[model samples]
Target: MSRKLAKEISWLLVTIALLTMFSPHTADALTITTTRKLVVLDPGHGGKDTGISSTTGILEKRIVLKLARMTSKLLSDQYRSLLTRTTDTDLSETDRATFANQNKADLFLSLHLHAGKNKGFFFYFDTPDNTPATNETTWKTQGLIHRDKNRQTAELFAKNSQTRNKKVKTHFAPAPVISLEGLQMTAILTEPFTITDIPGTAAEQDAFLAPYAKTLARCIETYFENKF
Candidate 1:
């Protein structure tokens, strides 16, 4: 071939090679493989803080502890799980969140029995600033996504409660700091039932709460399954 023709052929080859090298098919794209997530359960109030008292002398702390244990057991048997406080021990709210974060828990559940004359289960989600521990940066960096997932899980719990005639009420903390440190963690404060100071509420409380442990377990399972 003539020199000019050879040069042109070489340039065409180089151009084609460069195009192939930078082609979309040859580019590296991000791949996200979501695995099943482990969750942490925080049973509120312990040893020293008896929490609210029922007319029958049943303590809120004790009820929650029992329920938490049951839920943890069920989760362990059925799915991935962890517990922040397994026994009758007092744990600060911040500590609980820290533990969950340290463990890289996909979800955080703070369990408690209600008092103050409430009748049914109440599910509380964190607001942006309910606790002193919450701040703008934390909320923006970590709180938003966590809070959204928590709300999603809580809503699922509410929907599942319909099977037992138990109703769930979802409340957002008025301020970010009202519950725990709102920014660093995504947490749910679940008051399954009230150990009231009133009569005839004991049986009602049990009826409401007995299925809660199982229901919560199911919710966690479902959440992680869908998440992964």
Candidate 2:
């Protein structure tokens, strides 16, 4: 080949290689950072386990399930987020934690209702020591609870209590076995309302619970934006 022709062919090959290297296909394969956050909502007690029952016949499981659905809707509308359990089916505690971890959740909230001869909202968390007995005692005594690392975050929600008769308490419990093995932020179990067997508290419980759900949703949103 002529020297001039050889030079032109070599330049053409170099241009083609450069074009292939910078093509959209290559760019599409590059990893990109994600800013989206995910939260897992676990509505506790379902199926055969109806949870606590109120004098008015409202089941604890039902109330929490409804509240969870509402919270999921609010999160989706406000933050375009995700949820762990979106229905009234049974989910093992361990399974719930696994789902949250697998999804790379930023937060894991287990929603439940308090039951007894009393009424109020309560939040639960695992103790630093991971001892079940010690954790139960701590909760019974303080009513406001969590691991040392999560105390500040727990107090933020506890202080926002709006019930006239209900007081917010923080207490520690053994870390849920499911959360022990995974990457997750604080796993909070909230008793936003109560389903008491006590008389005359039924209507009161219903009245307090509906608004409580709304407030809790706001608190969660604020917590993530400001703290986590």
Candidate 3:
């Protein structure tokens, strides 16, 4: 073999050896390429549970479902938005929490429509039970680790949704009161507006839901920004 060809072969062998010594598949080389957060949107009440009733015949279940869909669409580009129910169906609170936990959602937002003479936003966070024992087997027994994170997210939603013209209220309750038990992630429930107390025609409810959905999307974005 020619000396030049032999030298080239030696160089190639050295390069291959170096690459084998410094492979990119090492644990330290691994990184998270996707930063998009996973958000679960649960539209409360469905089927037999019509929730609140409006004078114009708008049902709370239908309105909340619409808002959840729109909010999911708005956050599609920034986050992985998943809805617990896509249609009119009854889902138990346990089932809802299990869905969120199974999907490993980063946050849970239960969308609701209030049935009262008030027009305000109410954000509710989970008040979990006793802390789980520090054992691998009991990790899923309680949500104490996530309580602070849940409260922070819920507070951010309230702050972001509140404006000079609109005020957002917050409520703290146990898991039974808000149906947020069994969740392993940050959880929040939002009652954006009331259908029973709309100031305009029934058709105007759509318009109301539009901006409310946008506000929710914005709040979610803000929450993640501060979180990371």
Candidate 4:
């Protein structure tokens, strides 16, 4: 009600307007529109912690990172795509989940590979913790609140992959103790992308991930269109 207070508030508003008009991050800020859902892709393992390997010396960490980037590129035009780790570096499971939550992600996905044969895609949805967190209000239980949506999203992708000639098996795989804990969005993790499935060679990775990501992008689009 005081004139001094009114003048200060008006000055603040004018300053904010000027900053909004001239800030370099204006475009970046605008990209965070509500109309487009945000998807966070997490490539599991990095640095010294190489997940798995094959006879050809293909590292699981390397391949999954590339796959995450490829998939993000495919999804970029339709939705906001981001990755937890952009390079070959070690990122903790907690940090990855925090990144997704901080970004207010609409969906979260983790990519990993295993040392095994090509047994289709191992898709995962979050499950309740074996020993559920005592504090229900904590972030650790966020996945439990969104568990149904997470499972449905996993199923949607799995069904779509089958149509694309990729065999996908859906399972309730993660607990709060694992990578997907405390995510406040629909989450899925694809596992054990074998060397046989996506070989060590760049040529093989590209060949496998291109079509794989294409189908994945389409599946994500479908999920957003129908569900969100």
Best model per lDDT = 4
lDDT of each: 0.63, 0.59, 0.72, 0.74
Question: What digit string (tens of lDDT, one per residue) describes model 4 on residues 1-228?
Answer: 999999999999999999988996876767667667888989999989898787677788888888888888887465888899999998888899999999998888888765555444434434453443344557766766766676677667767777775454433344433677667788877763456565556787799778767777787788888965
Candidate of highest TM-score: 4
Report the error of model 1 at residue 60, Å.
Answer: 1.1
TM-score of 1: 0.65
Candidate 2: where are CA atoms >4 Å away?
1-34, 76-80, 116-121, 128-146, 163-183, 197-208
TM-score of each: 0.65, 0.62, 0.72, 0.79
Error at 68, model 3, angstroms: 0.2
**Candidate 3 wrongly placed segments (more than 4 Å):** 1-35, 117-141, 164-178, 198-203
In model 1, the runs with Cα more than 4 Å from the true position are 1-36, 76-78, 116-136, 139-142, 166-179, 182-186, 197-209
Q: Candidate 1 has which clashing residue pairs, if any?
A: 129-175, 129-176, 129-177, 130-175, 130-176, 130-177, 130-178, 131-176, 131-177, 131-178
* Residue 192 lDDT in candidate 3: 73
Candidate 2: tens digits of C-alpha lDDT, residues 1-228? 999999999999999889878797755543222344566777787877787887677777777777776676666343534555566677676677678767776666777776633434434455355553343452222212335534455555665544322554433343343333232456566665456632345465455555666666776787778755
lDDT of 3 by residue, 1-228 (tens): 999999999999999888867886642333332456888999999989988878877788888898999898887465778999999999998888889989888888898877654444444433345444343534343355566676666667766676522544544343533456567777777787767655455467667777888988888877777773
Best-to-worst lDDT order: 4, 3, 1, 2
All models, RMSD in angstroms: 13.5, 11.0, 9.6, 5.0
> Who is ahead in TM-score, 1 or 4?
4
